[model samples]
Target: MDFDYDLFVIGGGSGGVRAARLTAQDGHKVALAEESRMGGTCVIRGCVPKKLMVFASEYPEAIGYARDYGWDAKVGDFDWSAFSGHMRSELDRLEGIYETNAQKAGVKIYHGRATVEDAHTVKLGNGQTRTAKHILIAAGGHPVRPDMKGGDLGMVSDDVFNLEALPRKLLIVGGGYIGCEMAGIFNGLGVETSMMIRGAQILRGFDEEARGHIADCMGRRGVTIHTGCAPVEIEKRGDRIWVKGSSGHQDEFDDILWATGRKPNTQGLIAEGVGVKLDRRGAICVDDYSRTDVPSIHAIGDVTGRVELTPVAIREGIAFHETVFRGNKTPVDHELIPTAVFTQPEMGTVGLSEEAACEQEPTLVYATAFRPMQQAFAGGEERVLFKMLVSKETDRVLGVHIVGPGAGEMIQFVGVALKMGATKADFDRTCAVHPTMAEELVTMKEPVRVLD
Candidate 1:
């Protein structure tokens, strides 16, 4: 059967762009359609801009540390205008790169929404339809506000980067990574920041000890965390946004942010008769190879609700190319993925949490927490943690969790060892890097607890 193109991609995100470009480079007639920015969520409104804000927020703390190091470091008020302007420019540059790279690889780029009309047919918003031998859906997810009174008044994670001015007082709702990271960013920018989450602790799915440590550190740093609380009602009162929590707590803030959850961006994407299936969460149903129920249609990235991380989506894209285009049948490996949360005191973790590891088998836990040399010498109260969960039967590391500065960077290297099935003995025999916080990973001699 003849088709308008060999492949049609429905998103321009990291995953879609990757698959389109690589497949097009292999001499396939590939075209991509994106309704929004070319770089989609991660490059435009999500990771790139958020991480830049995280970097900007850290400068004031660094200035404080410099004063203790005998350097005259006087910090001034954060200039959100200056930083946001630069951030937007960086996003523009990145978006251009995404489009340019795809074009260079001979993939046609269409700037409009593309919906599946059939397994091989895609209809653009401009009233044109294109047919392809294979269709790829990589549309990412969007931050969703909870259903509540005056929820429209609350901003979302996407709206944070575009705020004209930082609020004097900000109330953040939710306890996930998005909410905690935003709380830190706003607090460091000199806003009176408060967070409300229904969970007993923030980062509910993480290691309990690590979550408590982060909550404690955030509280000590002046971010008021209202756990066991959630907004039941929100309204505007005079110049402030008033929120009434389920815990009977009431507060007024200059702005309210809703980071409660996210949903797949799949509305109106699949035609009614296309026979594409979606899961209970509205995520596209895809198999291990990212193939949809329909033979020629596939989905990846946040839309598939698998891992929900940018790099994982890229890997899925690569695997899709290997399977479909190269006949290699590569399935995505979702195990032992290392991830970092960019809070003030960051958290890096890979593999299972201690709670999860123990449930699977008898586990040994080793953990240490102390103020590192830099913070200790600077007279700071911030502490760092190095923890490992090991399988007692197999003698292999099941998990590695670190909470401190540069924890993210350290975890990437540690993730390599864990992915290679490195045992606890492999770490113990390795020479410790002298006078380093990470050396604690190797130097822990005994398990603090043995769980059966």
Candidate 2:
């Protein structure tokens, strides 16, 4: 059928942009609609800006290393307001880049929300119905605050980016990555930070070693972690917030951040008109190659909830082009995906946890622990832990986990190898680079791996 555009993308985030650009390159007209900025959550309010804060938070945490090495250095105090202002400027700069790239790729950018009017038609907020051969939903996700009264209890991850200033005392009300990250951030910046996770540990879905190392390190830095606790209410009490919780514990703080989690941003998409299937969390259900149940309609990124990370969205979008519009027709397998959590000490991991791997194969465990080379020079009592999970009989590495510096960077290649069924032998045969955190992955002796 002749259409206004070959593809109509209902998001301008990483996934939406990728789909629009690559599909456009495939000799098909593509138009993408975004209600706000060109960049989705990551470029706008998500990974990029958030990680910049994490990076800024790390400087203070790592500065102690210089002093520990007898470099008589006293890092000056951090100005929370200054960090906020700098981040705003950086985000502004990034917003423009996202806009220009889309234009250069010959993808029509619609600066308004899009609603699915039918299988091939999207009605933009500007009251125009654009029809296409295919429709892609990459609307992304939004932060959901905790159920509380006085809604002023706290702000979500999105609000943190727009902070007028950082609070000296932070009360993080969730145990997800955002909570773990911000808890580390404020505490590292010399603020008195407290974290309240309903479970025993923060970062529930991540590998245990990653959570363990972050929890231990954050504790060492004096961030009070309240586990097995859930906040019941949060209200301002003069200069502080009185937070009451399910555990009957009460705390007071100047700042409160509710990083409970995020929900799919589909409230006004009119998805029903196109018969798109969404799960209970509001995520569109997609098949192996990111196609929705309805053939002409597809979804990716946080909107799909298959993989919530930024890189995953980008990969899915790129793969959509390869698998659908392009001749390659490649499918995406989400297994062995490398990920990182930038908490106190930082962590990176790729593949299943030992427990999950063992569940698949009863006796698969590969665990290792040692101090990093930097720790040797930093003269600090810090030890980096590493773990791997592999099929005992097959010896095929199933997972690789790292907790230390450069974790996020090191795990990318590990993820590639693990995805290709790399065995412990492959890791062993690789020569180690001297004096690097990644060298530990190759040098560690594989003893009997233990399950979590």
Candidate 3:
């Protein structure tokens, strides 16, 4: 059957863009439709902008540390207007690059909302329909406000980058990475920040000890963290937002931000009409090869709810092209992916957490917590943690977790080692770099605990 194009991508996120570009580069006719900005969540709203904010917030702390090093240093008030203007400008540049790259690869770009009319047809917002031999869905997710009274009074993570002015006092809800990281960013920027979590601790499902250290450090750094409580109601009182907590405590803040969670963006795409299967969470159900129930349709990235990281999405797209176009079967490997949380103290972890490792095997934990030489000499109360989980029977490093400065950068290198099946002996034999926080990873000797 003749079609308008060989492939039609319904979203222009990292996953969709890569797939479209690669398929087009393979000499297939391809077109991509994006209703919003080309860069999607990571570049425009999620990781890129958020990390920039994190870097901006860290300057004040660095200035303070400078004073201890015998330099006369003082912190100036953060200028939100100036910083936000530059941030938006940078995002615009990145979005243009994404569009230009896709165009260079010979993929036609359509800037409008698109919905599936059938397994092989996509209808754009401007009253035009395009037919293709195959269709790909990679529309990402959006942060969702919790269902509660006066929920509209609160904002989500997306609204953070667009605030007219930084709040003098901010109340953040949830205990996940988004919530914790935002709390740190705002607190460092001189906002009186507070957070409420339903769970007993922040960063649930992570390395418990690492998260505990971060929570403690954040509290010491002036974030009013309330665990085992959530907002029951939010009310607007003049310019301030009043929140009633589950613990019966009430407070008022200049703004309330909800970092509760995100939902798959499968709503308006008409997946149901095309007989595509959706999971309970609204994510598209796909096979190992990213093919949906309809052979002509496929889904990847956050929309599929499988390892919703940006890099993972790109890998999935590569695998899809290999299987369908290059005639080589490829499946995305989701195991042992390293992740970092940009909290003030920071956290980088890979492989498995001690809690998760113990559930699977007899695990031995080697852990250390101490004031690093720099912080100790500078007379700061800050300390760093280095921990490794090893399989008792095999002497293989089951996990590596670090909480300190440069943890994110450290985990990226450690992730490679773990991926290569590096064991405890491999780490023990490697020489350590002197006068560094990361040296602790290879220096810890005895097992702190053994869980049978």
Candidate 4:
């Protein structure tokens, strides 16, 4: 069938943009429609901006460390106006790069919402219908507020990047990574930050010991954590937002932020007759190759609810191009992905948690927690943890989890070793980098406990 374009991408996110650009570069006519920013969540409202904020928030403590090291450094009052202005400029620059690169690759860009009219047709926001030989949906997810009264009075994670001023007292809801990270960020910025976690512990799926250590560290640093508590109601009085928790805790704050969770963008995406299957969470149900039920349509990224990470989305996009354009039949892989949570005492983990690995077979847990040399020398009480979950039967390291400085960067390297199926003996045979916290990984001689 003759079509207006060879491919129509319904999002301009990392996945859709890469797929559209690559397909267009391969001499196929491609059209990409985005309702919002070109760089999607990661580049615009998410990782980029959030990481910058994390960096910005760390300076006050860093100044204290510098003073401790005899540098006489001191932190001044944080100017929200100047910092937010710079963040805005940086985001604008990144958005321009996304659009320019796509254009350079010969992909036609549409700055409006696009919906599936059928398996091979897309209707834009202006009611203009365009038919394509294939359609790609990479529409990303959005942060959701709690479905409770006065929930609209609170802000989502997206609203954090645009705050005109930082609140003196901030109440954050949710126990996940987003909520914890923000708690650290705001607390570091000298805000009176408190977290209300409905779950028994923050970072519910992580290693239990690591979760406890992080919660303790955040608490020690002055972030109040209300665990096993959830907001039953929210009320506004004068300039204060009051929240009543299920645990009979009530507090008033200058602002309340909701970091509960995110949901996929699937509403109005697939037409009534299009027969695209969506899972219970409204995420597109696609096969290993990202192909939907209809042959001419596919979905990737957060919309598919598969490993909702930016790099994973880009990898899926490349896999899609390899399978469709290069005849390579590449299937997306989601195993052993390393992730980092940017809390004050950060966490980087790959592979299964100790609890998860023990369920399958005998496992040996090697772990250590101590005050690192840097912090110890400066009379700081900050502690770091290094843990490894090893399979007793196969002698392979099943998981590696680190909670400390540069854990994220360390996990990336450790992830490569884990991916190559490195065993405990392999780590033991390696020499430790002296005076480094990561040396603990190679030096832990015995299992703290054996789970059979």
Per-model TM values vs. the true structure: 0.99, 0.95, 0.98, 0.99
TM-score of 2: 0.95
Candidate 4 lDDT tens digits, 1-452: 79999999999989999999999999999999999999999998899999999999999888888888999788999998899999999999999999999999999999999999998889999999999998999999999987788899999999999999999999999988999999999999989999999888999899888888999999999999998899998988899999999999999999999999999999878889898999999999999999999998989999999899998999999999999888999999899899999988999999999899999899999999999987887899988999999999988999999999899999999999999999999999999999899999999999999999
- lDDT (Cα, tens digit) per residue for candidate 3, span 1-452: 89999999988889899999999999999999999999899999999999999999989988988999999999987999999999999999999999999999999999999999998899999989999999999998999998888899989999999988999999999989999999999999999999999999999999999999999999999999998889988888999999999998789999999999899999878745679988999999999999999999999999999887898899898988888889899977888999999998999999899999999999999999999887787888988999999999999999999999999999999999999999999999999999788888889899999999
Ranking by TM-score: 1, 4, 3, 2
TM-score of 3: 0.98
| TM-score for candidate 4 | 0.99
> Per-prediction RMSD in angstroms?
0.7, 1.9, 1.0, 0.8
Instruction: State the local distance difference test value for candidate 3.
Output: 0.92
Candidate 1 lDDT tens digits, 162-280:
99999999999999999999999999889999999998999989999898899999999999999899888888899999999999999899999998999999998888989999999
Against the reference, the lDDT scores of all candidates come to 0.94, 0.82, 0.92, 0.94
lDDT-wise, the better of 2 and 4 is: 4
Total clashes for model 1: 0
Q: In angstroms, give how far residue 338 of model 1 lies from its true place.
A: 0.5
RMSD of 3: 1.0
- Expressed as tens digits, the lDDT of each residue in 1-452 for candidate 2 is 78999889988888889888888877788899999887889988878987888888778656778788777787897887788888888888888888788888888998888899988899989788999988889999999875558556688888888877678788888888888888877777778999888998888977766677778888887889899988877778898888887888897888888888899998878655567888998888888889887888888899988889888898989988887787687687786678888776778888787667767875456666667777776766777777777677787888888888788888888888987789888888999998677776777665565543
